[model samples]
Target: MYRERAIRLAGAVRWESVSAGDEPVRVLPDGCLDLLWSSGRGLLVAGPDRTAHLSVSAPGERWVGLRLPPGVGPAVFGVPADELRDRRVPLADLWGPTAVAVADRVADGRDVAAVLEEVARGRLVAAGGPDPLGAYLAGRLAAGGPVGAVAAEVGLGARALHRRCLRLFGYGPKTLARILRMRRALALARAGTPLAEVSAAAGYADQAHLTRDVRDLAGVPPGVLLRA
Candidate 1:
């Protein structure tokens, strides 16, 4: 497995990915936005204009995941998070011409960082926003840093914060928390920690709760992912 720092390219963004076997399975739930362009292998995607579930079962050894930063997604894909709920769009369609251009640039030996900066800036320029809520939620998600008290710290009532988050982040606060928590759990599991300890440390109610979350979000039992 590897973790590489990536920057957005001119007209697009990229994310660091960690993978396993030649044909590893990846399961992602509703939340986050991306525009992926792949040559081969198809995926099963669920959800609509707000949330989505994607399952990739592939025989190909190569997989790349691009995670669009909050506001930047709608600008690139023309499908704002506000418009996406349970819909699943293919990477080819989502990537459009921008993806092709970026790939060509990358292949031409241009600096990835410089290319990403140009891409990001171009999109930001096109997408004008008075997006206070989106800005607030992005900062909150970053600073929340794996805690349930993000709402309280922001001085928002739980219910109000929940609604605001839905509009801004395209997912409820609880769902975001579960996603973050499960992500941490997956890391701990991969690091060889015991399941019970991982569950407690990751703040799940119990091992069973952790298992369920993993199953739902990752489409695999905790045991299976850990061993991978």
Candidate 2:
């Protein structure tokens, strides 16, 4: 199993990452935008709105991951999930100018983590301090899924949550909840548990509920992952 976490870089930016996985693993649908960047192997991403897939398999055991912000739509990356029917972009292209800087930094014997930190610091002014989006995400993640509990934690009404989420993450609270829940579900599925058990462990209502979620997010049934 791969243990992944959100890293706080030099700036107020963060990226979800995995350290190991010999073969290219596919990231199923999760209702969130993943700005993946690779250091050793190339990553292939594909899928439709709300159901994108990413495949990264390289020879060397190196670092690679996705960078997802709190907001939605393409602020500066590739096309937003809602805009295209199906598309794919290389990890290098996602960062644009930042990628060039990262290359130079890495060329100068800097680690990817250090480069990420530096890039983050350069954009620190763009985002700093406690962000509404970060708060909302933290609340959602801590709740183990997106629940009404987040509304209370953020001190916002239901309508206010929608508005703030729109202003911050692009997608609404419900959308984010689905995405986070799917992420947890995928993690559980990868752990080699039964579909029904994974569903319950991932906070789904039941096996059918988990199946629906897996099908919607991953474009494949839970059985596929189990067999793999």
lDDT for residue 120 in candidate 2, whole number 0-100: 44
Cα lDDT of candidate 1 equals: 0.56
Which sections of candidate 1 miss by over 4 Å?
Answer: 1-4, 8-24, 40-65, 69-79, 90-117, 125-149, 155-160
C-alpha TM-score for every candidate = 0.63, 0.60
Model 2 TM-score on a 0 to 1 scale: 0.60
Instruction: Summing lDDT over every window of 10 consecutive residues in candidate 1, give the lowest-scoring window.
Output: 43-52
- How far is 54's C-alpha from truth in model 1 (Å)? 4.9
**What is the clash count of model 2?**
6
Report the number of the highest-TM-score candidate. Answer: 1
lDDT of 2: 0.55
Tens-digit per-residue lDDT, 42-115, candidate 1: 32112223222444434433434455544345554555455555555653455567666776775576654455
- Each model's C-alpha lDDT? 0.56, 0.55
Task: Give the per-residue lDDT digits (tens) of candidate 2, residues 1-228.
Answer: 344556553122334455455666665544434433455544322223356455555544455344444443233343444433245555355556656666666667755555554454444434443244555564565357554777777677889877666544445677667766776776777776766787778788998988887777667777786576
- On lDDT, the leading prediction is 1
What TM-score should be assigned to candidate 1? 0.63
